[model samples]
Target: MSAILESADIDRALKRISHEIIERNHGLESVVLLGIPTRGAFLATRLAQILKSLGNEVPVGTLDITMHRDDLRLRPPRPLLSTLLPPGGIEGKHVVLVDDVLFSGRTIRAALDALGELGRPKTVQLAVLVDRGHRELPIRADYVGKNLPTSSNESVKVSLLEVDGHDSVEITGAR
Candidate 1:
């Protein structure tokens, strides 16, 4: 495996992304962040910290898409994580879906389905740490930390400090 992003690099990318999000929205007003469970939640918290530093107090939530995935029957049933939203919920708010990596776009699709059931947001944006192209769906991330053109055989792994005890991204060769 080859290390593609170190801790500092990931931080820098997230900082940049936070700024972009703030800039695009013209401010943090009426904005909410929902992270796809696991690493995405970590990233959302990190981004929230950066946004706080920027003087924008935005709400962050966790979205668990386990039941919304297309291949649900392909695997055995497992425990589902909690899907927590802010106090007011996503009603007419600008919701930003955050994730560690964007690969097949299936996860984001599942997230979209999951989001729809919660509440109808004014707009839904996607933010990903890495955008490794090989899209099975037409989904795309609005803000990408690093656009690493990787082969379909290779796998990109993102390790976050919140869960993995470290923040780094590595590319592992095909099995």
Candidate 2:
């Protein structure tokens, strides 16, 4: 069986996360939102907008961890990947990494490695639209839109208005 959350719910979740970020950071300055590409990129932009609405000036960036992934040699190769470093290196700034879903945590590991190549940041935290558990690494999101307790055989799919023409989160069995 599959479950869905309406667009309104999604927006509320994002706004909550944004508020949490601002509160935890004691306000925003020299902060960056870097998405993990694909769905994460869209979510990152949305988060940036929310922060901006809250009167915070923050820069958003994108990252491609395809090559830095440990499973790169095992999984199908991804092409046209871009690992553009932030115009301003992460040093002395707070960086919040964004992703659509949190699963085995391997993706976060890869993204961390990719970030190292770019530049060091004063701090790095995670923000995910959905957290499905079953982490294989010691990682946790600082701000999560939703905590979805799901099975290993299932997956959380997040569709954003910018990329999917809709806004919602769905859970379905893995094919």
Q: Each prediction's TM-score against the native? A: 0.98, 0.94
lDDT per residue for candidate 1 within 1-175, as digits (tens), equals 9899999999999999999999999998899999988889889989999999988999999999998989989889968986899897999999999999999999999999999998899999999999999999999899999999999999999998788888889999997
Record all residue pairs in model 2 with backbone atoms less than 3 Å apart, i.e. clashing.
none
lDDT of each: 0.93, 0.86
Q: Candidate 2, overall lDDT?
A: 0.86
Best by lDDT: 1
Q: Once model 2 is optimally superposed onto the true structure by TM-score, how far is the C-alpha of residue 60 displaced, in angstroms?
A: 0.5
Model 1 earns a TM-score of 0.98
Model 2, 1-175: lDDT tens per residue?
4556779988898899999989988888778899888888888889989888888878888989887778768867778465555677688789999999999999999999988888888999999989999999999999998889887987778888888898888988876
Error of 2 at 70 (Å): 1.2
Cα lDDT for residue 157, model 2? 80
